[model samples]
Target: MNTFQLSCFLAVAEYLNFAQAAKQLHVTHPAVSQQIQSLEKELNVKLFQRTTRSVKLTDEGKVFLWDAKQIVAISDRAKKRFGGVAGGNIETLSIGCYNFPCMFLLADTLETLRTIRPELHPRLQEIPFQHIYRMLEEGDLDAVVGFKESANVKINALYKEVAKVPMVCICSGSHSLAGQKELRLCDIKEERFVLFVPPKGMLSIAQTQGQLMGERPPSEFYFCESAEAITVLVKAGYGISVLPDFLVPDTPLISRIPLKDVDQVSFGIYYKSLQGNPALKAFIQCAKENLTALDI
Candidate 1:
């Protein structure tokens, strides 16, 4: 009936132990019991089955549990939206990012939200490129920065473009192959390779270069989900990899060499249609100013 009752109900239903739930909620055990009893009376249902030893939710309680959580979520979103109504505009922005590019902007972007966009808080999540599209469709994320061009992904092609940096073939600086003036696909056909698995098998700039020289995909691979993970393995002298120039950070063991024959992926912002929120115009303008996007 009220927020207090709903909060108490959730705590009790989740833990099924009045004492434990009370401790978690920082309320007295009797207060928890009374709240649940009051909620049961308000709803006109036996929400819980209680014994001296244990507690269990009734079927009705289980069904109502889901609705209770949504009620809280909607309440929170409403609070955020309501805050914007007071001053200028307050909206929550959730941005999904692929692992490779997130390292650069994640901290800085959030810091700006803390200072500049004091009203509109932004939440950042690391996600695979495929998950971004699905989340956008479900209205989970407000935007993403990814290389993929899919049907559902709407691109905001701002003035900045992701520069075409040659995909560099990375090897341990001490590895015998590292000394070569240039590398062709034939250089490492017999050697083990480390690769970051591409979403939808989108060939990276290096993979495209490998194809240009008629090289077969490596026989063995150490597949990595994150660029950071791939670089760690490469630093440990695992095997050669074709990685974006950005990922080759300041690591001592790894070295990058241009592949000479591949196109660079465009780096840009992707957001769902702004039909739901009319205030995206100002936010997009702020984004354009903040992002100093360039080739890696």
Candidate 2:
């Protein structure tokens, strides 16, 4: 099969839905289906089991997924290497960061990069949690700083867990639950909940929360675009929310309480190990140093 067919397969496999995969690849559903059909024909094996309601990988498809990822990773790395040589050497290292990390760690990382690697120009982009891996695989980003759990998609990348931050439940100071020392998932089940909704086809904050609460869905949900907005809404008495400890603002109008059972959020930097850019290497080193100094 060709790279195009392999890419289509990878996207479909990751998302397990042709429509979502097509949207991520910026192609139509029929085109994605055609590529998958062509690849299955070439390989003489059925990769996916499809039904009207759901799509799943066959035993053979699960085995091929790893090899397909390797092929795409190698191809992308080669293109980057040759493209750099043809374009007269790469000068700038492009880094991506999600909103939370962008607010908390980006400035320090940039400062460290400037002090240690003054010769290399760095370009930082504010990316959504869902787009980070795709941009890195497409060679548009050299490195990224984001929540570790958000990088669950299987891809060719290296992740260094620099910090672990606990998540806290937040509510207005006047809310009934604010004065409670300990908060449980069931306690907030009936409260109006403000949740962060990522871009289309990405894992959402609400889904994560559901998993945290043992698959017990929130009673009433309010979807928003960012954690900052959630904070604003919480303070305005709109709804309560759970946010990373670092993102919780020091506001008198809100109270941050501990949750009963939830995992700490792992925050860190991710980059493709196959990338041999000197600037990228230096940036990663500086990032680790800064993170350690900040004790995050």
Best by lDDT: 2
Model 2: lDDT equals 0.77
Residue-by-residue lDDT tens digits, candidate 1, 1-296? 87777888888887888888899989999998898889899899988899998889999999999988989878888888756755675568777776645446445445554565566666678786656667866778777755546334354432223234456778888888777766766566676777756443344543453453354554566777666777788778887777666656667677777665445555546666766753344445444545444335
Among these predictions, the greatest TM-score belongs to: 2
Tens-digit lDDT track of model 2 for 1-296: 88999999999999999999999999999999999999999888999999999999999899999999999999999898787646454368888877753445667877877776666677778886667779988889888777664445675678886766666789999988889887767677667777776442223344556654454455566667776788888988888888766677668888999776666676677888735687777776776677666632
TM values, all candidates: 0.56, 0.58
Clashing pairs in 1: 84-90
Clashes of 1: 1
Question: Candidate 1: which stretches are off by over 4 Å?
Answer: 1-89, 109-116, 150-166, 177-191, 198-201, 205-218, 274-295
Task: Report lDDT per candidate.
Answer: 0.66, 0.77
Runs in model 2 lying further than 4 Å from the true structure:
1-91, 100-104, 150-152, 179-182, 198-208, 211-219, 292-296
